[model samples]
Target chain A: MAGVRILVGTAKGGFILRGDERREHFTVEGPLFGGWEVFHLAASPVDPERLYASQAGGWFGQIVQRSDDGGRSWNPVDNAFVYDGEVGDHLFYDGTPQPWTFQKVWHLAPSLTDADVVYAGVEDAALFRSDDAGASWGELTGLRQHPSGTQWQPGAGGLCLHTIVQDPTDPGRLTVAISAAGVFVTEDGGASFDPANRGLQSGEIPSEQAEVGHCVHKLAQHPSRPQTLFMQKHWDVMRSDDGGGQWTEISGDLPTDFGFAIDVHAHEPETVYVVPILSDSEHYPPDGALRVYRSRTGGGEWEPLTRGLPQEHCYVNVLRDAMAVDTMDECGVYVGTTGGTVFASRDGGDNWEAVVDHLPRILSVEVQTLP
Target chain B: MIRVTLPAHLRTLARTGREVVVEAAGDPPTIRTVLDALEGAYPVLRGTIRDHTTRQRRAFVRFYACGEDLSQLPPDTPLPDEVVTGREPFAVVGAMAGG
Candidate 1:
């Protein structure tokens, strides 16, 4: 029990990898929901044994599976993500408003305090809550009904609410980021929300400072300093200091800022991690060199960490939700590549090694720190 | 009694024999009645074959009986006599891929 277990969700199934605190040796468990598309996998904060996954079938729609005993066994829970009241429409790719429809669950963020309560971010852009231990889901329609809803358009990945970050200091405070839509923050729980995309720019859009419609790929925040945030935009790396009130570009010195996946170090608040893709259209590393860039000065300056990683002839891309950090003293960093490899670093980001390689394409990766 | 054949995934989910017999409950045996009985008997299959709220067949699912595509027919439409009489299992199938 004094080690680390990683929860990995992939295109083919869900897998659990276990290792010692050093993270050198490991055991790979499963392809749990084989043949299903597992979009996101996460473990409940209070109870590491409790886990939840966002899975969907080609024909059966989305299903939420829960495991009370870590990843040993799984049971399909209430995956009925019915929107509150009559769901309206959001702007489509063509700019023609289309009816809002439930597509799939994109992300699941379990509550830090209550194992029974978890937040789900979904596609077609909405947030849902399941307080009954993933037995049922009810949409928090207030976020979707924001005045900026009409202006939100789909990114290449569709308009999906992919990032869910809860403030550690205030239990009621929550923040979510949607692709092509931007960021929204709720101070009084999910009853209401406000667009938090001030000082952001999108090259595709005509506005230099639009309130919404920014394609935020991934976002991560340190628990001790929740107000300060880091983001990997569709084209740039940005940081927000005032709880997303405003953001400034911090893509300095990286080969390219366009990438997915951003995470804060477990122990170092100023340290952050991101994998730089060549560009949105290319979806590969710069010059086929897979590097994990770390920003120790909180984003203005950066350095690349690549020891055991593929520095040559690697063209895999890390998805937005594929990177995670473990709360160990040395602080471990992990990222899942689209090519089906999970790379891990135990001594911060100085060096990395693959825990498990050659499975299905990875969609997300999460870690559990055990006592 | 009615005989029903489920798609592979649904069969695995329902945890039943490939061909199952349902009582059709207290109603005349129709496609809807048999489906309702199947769902009631296997709770795990709820919303798998049809929309949970609308009860419409999933876009990729189809119904066939007596070698005819009964998918376009309304849910309330009476299934063919062979299916209701258990002479043939009402085939619930995954629509052939790519039309």
Candidate 2:
């Protein structure tokens, strides 16, 4: 078996895309997390056998599930990351006696060097770290217990860390993006984190409501230059060179400022992809054009990649996890939309082809080379 | 008496065009009662809107009316009297997709 595989997380469950170097095919072996919407799907950086999925709310509430054997079977990690007093000495900062809302797990990252050290960013502005490969987790005391956490108003999705970017070179270095909460980074594991939204814009609130944190939609990191980061903000696509210390708007020439997902090439950090949508009115694209923008010089300039896409009125929203870039030679760039359509670009967004459609609202898209 | 609108797909499945009329016994109608009335009139919609066990709305369906996310509103909650009076229509939007 080739070490290439693709996992598409949708409102229904997750579908594994299996195929060879010459031709790839998709099989819907899912509804993996019961009837919940799986928004985040991640593969174990240390072990290919392990897979993790964070399901968005539906019938089963928000939940996370683990699979030890590809996508064939799955079991919920009962103690995935409970914050109640019953689980060890861990506790929330507010000390509120009420239980957590069981918020959605928006993003998951298997540790870069430590096999068992997994990180999860969840709704309600919570951050958790697991030293046991997600079997159990502890809240990041600094971010979770920050004085500001309680007052942080929840975005439409809630005050959540939707993206987690870890420095592959330095295990201690990490960055997290929270919707409406801006961006935060840690240099020493997670003992502490500082607001990194120096030049980033955090939309306008009444002066009384304004503070740190920006309304960050999505973010991507350069594999070679960790300090260089790309982000899709609430109303703009911007980039930070000094590690979020400052930002520059790169979305000047796009169709619209509103978009959910952003991806960087595995080999070419400068190359990135984004699915543009109309700002959050009805949360669909303007004029229903199904197009994605590609940037080759780290958002220096972007061009619309619209080969093989629907030209008529198409009002589909693509979630952040729904678009990704694989490491194949031609580099497979895939994006799933709320219309239940999954499109793939084999020539690195230069050309496109429809892989599947009419399945379910897609939540996340992950690609791996199967062995 | 609250008014609930169904997307074109479910309406097609129910053999209706678009938007089916449903009746509720309470003041402020809820997702459950409206869905119950819809299912009662069209048995074909029984297991489609929500599961029999959980009664939770399917992932693809969104419940909106009077600026509220009826999805989380308790199934038994009173849907606003306006909706019950047929003066206002609660929209059940179908999430769109592409790209």
For each candidate, give the TM-score of chain B: 0.90, 0.82
Question: Which residue pairs in candidate 1 collide?
Answer: none
Off by over 4 Å in 2: A56-62, A84-100, A206-211, B1-99
User: How do the predictions measure up, each by TM-score?
Assistant: 0.97, 0.73
Comparing to the true complex, what docking class would candidate 1 get?
A: medium
User: Candidate 2 chain A, which ten residues in sequence have the lowest lDDT sum?
Assistant: A84-93
Candidate of highest DockQ: 1
Cα DockQ of the candidate 1 complex: 0.58
Please write out the lDDT profile of model 1 over residues A228-271, one tens digit for every residue. Answer: 99999998899999999989999999999999999999988999
Those runs of model 1 whose alpha carbons end farther than 4 Å from true positions after fitting are B25-27
Q: Cα lDDT of all candidates, in order?
A: 0.88, 0.72
True contacts kept of 2: 0.07
Q: B62 in model 2: Cα distance from truth in Å?
A: 23
